[model samples]
Target: MGRKEDQDKVQSVLELLKKQAPLTLKQEKFCNKACVERFLKAKGDSVKKAAKQLRNCLSWRDSIGTDNLIADEFSAELAEGIAYVAGHDDELRPVMIFRIKQDYQKNNSQKLFTRLLVFTLEVAIQTMAKNVDQFVLLLDASFFRSASAFMNMLLSTLKIISDYYPGRVHKAFIIDPPSMFSYLWKGMKPFIEYSQLVLVVSSLDFEESFEFNDYTSYPRVTSLRFDPSSIPSTKLGPCSSSRFSFTVSHSCDSVKPWYLSLTDTSASKVGPTNSSQISLGPVISPLNARSQSFASPIDRGLRRNDNFIRKGFFPSTPMPQKTQSLDPSMIHHPRTPKPSFLQSPALFFRKDYQVSRVEKSRDSFQSFLKFYRRPYDEMIYRSKMKPPLGGLISIVSPQLKRRHMSISQRF
Candidate 1:
């Protein structure tokens, strides 16, 4: 149903397809004005390019038997729902999700995975009704451990969809790409049209890009009503609620942490004990249990003493019984003097102390350390060197002595 002015342009492409492809009964029945227009647009309205694209599509159908792809025969495999034609976007374009981990082949062969993928996509293409020619794809790569396992499969799929199935994807949303994607995408991106593909890094990004209310408010171009119930329950995205958000609010509690699978081959290492013969403590008598609750040194003065306890330089905790049990003579011993040094600036810059700060502050400090490693290392080494610098500065510049001492001690 194109405008009157577009009839000749459409007919020109149709004549080219007839000459190049020579449609059979099935191809002739499949040929439609809308489908033909998509080919023309995909090839930038060039009859030669459009004919070539259409010819490739015909060849692909012949080789793959796309007409024979039925969902019923693959029900057992499809029950796992590796890929499916689910709801439609605001434009009535079909939405499909490709989950890598759920669909990973047990034999770990890319061939089997590709067959399943192509079958699912073919089934999805069949769901394209009337003038709706394209589908939206949501690629869930969150569970994929490495891109090397599926990079080639992804490339091949993209090639098939772009070359043989031109203009079949209105928009594609790729979700939760593995850490390796940043490196692999550099090469794969050039082949993909950026206008149709969106690499979503997080749920927040997904919500920002697409939402249900967006298309609802805009004036309707056709008589398409979005049926909420038609959308399947999706765990991979945040659109579960009515908000039309794609935030990742839910996780499968039954599945263990992904890293647990990457552990040592020997599978007998689950425990709280030091089963690997790793010694964790010196086992000094438990004088007191230091409360792990940590805050600023000023706010938790007594708690700061754990720094000394960790190094076995001071009693773990000053319980009433242990303090009373100490011999009267040893109570005031010069060597056992209270670790007044706990308040010294030297305690502030210790790696352990810095890492124990509030979570945000600790993360910021750690990130800073990554960029300023050389300066930080030199300062820390200078700080640990005692006597010469600490005392010499105290004597040479008495007025600036405290500032120098604090900076040196903390470093």
Candidate 2:
């Protein structure tokens, strides 16, 4: 009934609401905090109810229109899991970051790409409602799975956003190929023909890209600078060399800087005994150092402990060492051919030696290899050669289908 009692009660309610609407590994915390305060102030008498409403407002629990294609099995499960994850946490709801590595097409259709992306973006956007801001995306060149059936679903969706919302995306991009965005034409070039431009960010010597116009014209890119402060000096540990982004940084610099060069001694950027050779030479220009880093999407949140809590959201996984990549081709691939059985996951799993199918198949390995090499002279193979039906066909060839009859030898 008293004024002081009312003030304390309201403050407590506001605090609880702030704690509940966690900022998680995202960028929306400041807006969330301000929004919560406003909500509480408005509903003075029943501020607890107001706080609850505010929390729900900030969450993905609210109604969002979904493209009917995604309305089926996966979307329902996704919605529930996101809400479930949000339910367990402190203040922030979990954020989902989706990036497109390739301009996706189904069989060979843009319509297919659009529909898939719509469905994907629908759920991904919904997933971002309560928890995430676009601040921290854990980008690995090998963009692996995050959750159930994620790779297929995620790639499909990211392609859509890359085509549509280039300016909005703030996640750190790694060197995943076939990914088309404002500049890169890994796959989505058809959609952006003559309309957009892609900049070559790396410092390496690249064959000239197929031409497209850069859209520095509108909302216009008045200036662009690579922010090096956000990039981590070391990706793995003390003695490993980074392949992608550092080379891009090297590309921007003149006078073979040791850090940019493959042969720098100050760096553990390479590997094993050779890592010591990878080092940044003398800093040449201040601009190069600035260009050397990717300016990370700024975090606007308060600190908690060893980890900082932006708003109320905690980092779901570890914060990534933001990397600036050269081009997709630069991400490391071993030049040597790996044994088929050792190379792929599908093969590794199905390769039970006891299986009669596998034993029969092995007999024909030489037959398949026969065509791969032309009379066994040249070792050069097209690095980009994909197998028939769209993947490494050498690994999964029709010869696999042919039954090699066993000829039991009689002495």
Global Cα RMSD, each model: 31.4, 33.6
**Cα error, candidate 2, residue 274 (Å):** 50
Q: For model 1, what is the alpha-carbon lDDT of residue 121?
A: 66
* Minimal lDDT window, size 10, model 1: 367-376
Q: What C-alpha lDDT values do all the predictions have? A: 0.54, 0.36
Best by lDDT: 1
Tell me how far the alpha carbon of residue 337 in candidate 2 is from the true structure, in angstroms, after superposition. Answer: 41
Q: Can you give the lDDT of residue 291 in candidate 2?
A: 29
Stretches > 4 Å off in candidate 2: 1-67, 71-108, 129-168, 176-411
Model 1 residue runs over 4 Å out of place are 1-5, 102-115, 125-131, 194-196, 204-411
Tens-place lDDT per residue, model 2, 367-408, is 222121111111111111132211243355444676566666
User: What TM-score does model 1 achieve against the real structure?
Assistant: 0.48
Question: Candidate 1: lDDT of 93?
Answer: 64
